[model samples]
Target chain A: MGVEGVEPHYQIVVTRDGSLDNIEVQVEVSEQIFSDEVKSLEKLGKRLQTEIKDLLGISCRIKLVEPKTIQRSEGKAKRVIDNRKI
Target chain B: MKVKQIAIFLENKSGRLADISHTLAANAINIRALSLADTADFGILRLVVSETEKAQQVLKSAGFTVGITEVLAVEVPDKPGALDLVLQVVSKAGLNVEYMYAFTRKSGETGMLLFRFDDQERAIKAFQDAGCKLLSDEEVHAL
Candidate 1:
């Protein structure tokens, strides 16, 4: 919990390609969480996924990227990119 | 004993790696050794190139995220168990290798390998003390 009050930014997307069903998620975290922190990031992501599945019943894929690499934001920032076809 | 290696962040999509290699080729940046580690969505392309500055500049300006890290280039004899000996030395010294890649020198007599270690100074000292030959940037680039 030494994140220093930095809330991570993440995104989720659900899509079906041909017969394959998939959900992808991207998490934007500070550089401080890295440098031998990959396992921890994956753990946090899986926890979130479990909660989401229990509530919404959908699984997801997760990715991690730097905040600046994605975009600069003044507030909570955009967190979802749903390109799934209906 | 430390060589500059460029790390490029690439999205896991077709043509991304091709785009990077093409751009480097067009700019005349020669790739000496390379490694790619990836997840399902993204990848980190690590490269030892002829010109680090030029490659970094061109790649960054081309909008491909890039960064530089120092790696140690060691020369081991082109024989069986040569690399195992080096790894043994590092392990005995209690150093960890983040990642590594190897290439045969243009001469084909000796094998050249790049190693990234968190404690580079200690790793270098360990290698040196163990009588392993190390290659400078010029020596590596020449081959």
Candidate 2:
């Protein structure tokens, strides 16, 4: 997490379409999290995808979302949402 | 002098920019100048508005990711090579211009260039030493 000014809130939504399964990680970000020298959203997504693949041994997709875009649960924060069909 | 600018993170979807403008208009936020940088998936909208705090609050309340940054506003003469002269000064000082945009006043003979530099303090010092006309926050808002 060397990237500066990145909000810690995120939501991982897992979805499957017929035979295709995908794990999408949506991260809340700000302007400081990116710059002209550093990479763009696509590069950040690729990096996150690699990290997730290494940690969980599965491929996933990364989505950079606006701050506070993810819902905050009142009772307990739900970090992961599974929308995959069995 | 340094001017406060607002940077908003917007998803590259249809009507997203319109939504932001509509929200600001409803709140009476006057955008003095603006620049939009985009990629395949997202866009960063940099705006110099008359009311910085109000614009930030309204945009945030409207569910837009907004950030405030201090940028340098330089008044360039309305003539050819005016910007080039300024750039030469910046280049000689070894300053990097991260991004910049220009806007002209309706009744003025000088145009303003909004710049986001990598090293803001150093850029300010360089401009001052080079005798560049830097606009203050009040002057920018007044324009």
Candidate 3:
């Protein structure tokens, strides 16, 4: 998921709850746009969470990050890292 | 003067912080000052430590997202309005403080405040020109 200037790459991580839990989306944003602006990123992240929940009908938590901080691949970008416990 | 601060990306899970501290401690890296900023999922643990490069390597090898940021360290008298005055000067100079944190040394005579500004040079000039007592890198690390 991405906005105009803020591009987000995400990973799916398991929730803390044991029995039943909503999906969690860990988003890595492009640093060129957000830099370290936490407030702005928080706002954008909330909007993204709302939009995702509405579109997919599956509620999930959003975690924002910087792009280079996340691992990259050679050919196709490895967007989502599945950390969800099976 | 600028001080090197290490920012570690920590997942919001039990024992994450403990694991980091233990890793550093086991490697003989002393943490001088630290601040943890977090959301529900993850936390950013910023630290002023004894050795920058070694600490970075240790943390990275331990599988943590580590980054180094140059921050200004200002020593202010441990009293009321000391920090407010510094902020006022920064605001008056039209500088933005990205983030800031405070720590006290063992001496207790003065307090150290770590400030991150978008423009490092501008902030340094503003604070210096305003005659705010700033700490050198050596001074900060020694503390």
Candidate 4:
């Protein structure tokens, strides 16, 4: 298994009645997940949506937000979400 | 007039549905109305249950990706176009239904419908305006 750790996805769907209207599915990752050129989560959202549609045959709107703040201490770095307020 | 439904993404594999059932059973949650949305590689388990909070916790703790959704428990006579009627409303509203499945009831006079739209909140409002009965969280829990 290519178990390179796991990233958690919190999918929020804004549906009217039982029909899907606009979907906002997001995944939150630590700061390190945002590499050098990837400045925003929009890229991730597009990637996931395409993947989902290809897999499910249902198109959905998605939003991914990865706010990674961390300081390397001991053996691991703790990513924080505090940077979004500014 | 609305029911709280939980949709859990299930990997398509042997015993997947049974696993969900066992997990819910372990927590003493009883299912009321349920339907399944499926693709080739995966499936979504839409369940209306007696205990939402407990069921939510059970599913999350089990590491199954889940979502809380609003679904229409519309009833129709066991006849053709009964389903088409709902579809018509959805189409009229310019809403694209991602998926839907039909269910038969124990009474044998009615067929229960479960569906998902692009926008759930609007879909609910539209159906209610059109006089479709929506099951609430309490109503689903009681059953």
Which candidate tops TM-score?
2
lDDT of each: 0.75, 0.83, 0.78, 0.62
Q: Candidate 3's error at B17, in angstroms?
A: 0.4
lDDT of 4 by residue, A1-86 (tens): 11122254343445443443555454544333332112223354456677778887777665433222112357643322222222
Off by over 4 Å in 1: A1-11, A14-24, A27-61, A65-86
For model 1, the DockQ equals 0.18
lDDT of 2 at B50: 84
TM-score for the first chain in candidate 3 comes to 0.67
DockQ order of candidates, top first:
2, 1, 3, 4
Chain A TM-scores of all predicted models? 0.57, 0.76, 0.67, 0.48
| DockQ, each predicted model | 0.18, 0.34, 0.17, 0.04
Give one digit per residue, the lDDT tens place, for model 2 in B44-71. 8989998999998998888887888888
- Write one digit per residue (lDDT tens) for candidate 1, span B40-123: 665678898899999989987777657777889999888789889999999999998777889877454789878888799999
Cα deviation of B125, candidate 3, in Å: 1.0
Q: What is the TM-score of each candidate against the true structure?
A: 0.72, 0.79, 0.71, 0.57
For residue A74, model 1's alpha carbon misses the true position, in angstroms, by 16
- Candidate 1 residue B120 Cα shift, in angstroms, is 1.1
Candidate number with greatest lDDT: 2
Arrange candidates by TM-score, descending: 2, 1, 3, 4
Candidate 1 residue B116 C-alpha distance from true site, Å = 0.9
Task: Enumerate clash totals for all models, in the order shown.
Answer: 2, 0, 0, 26
The value of fnat for model 2 is 0.28
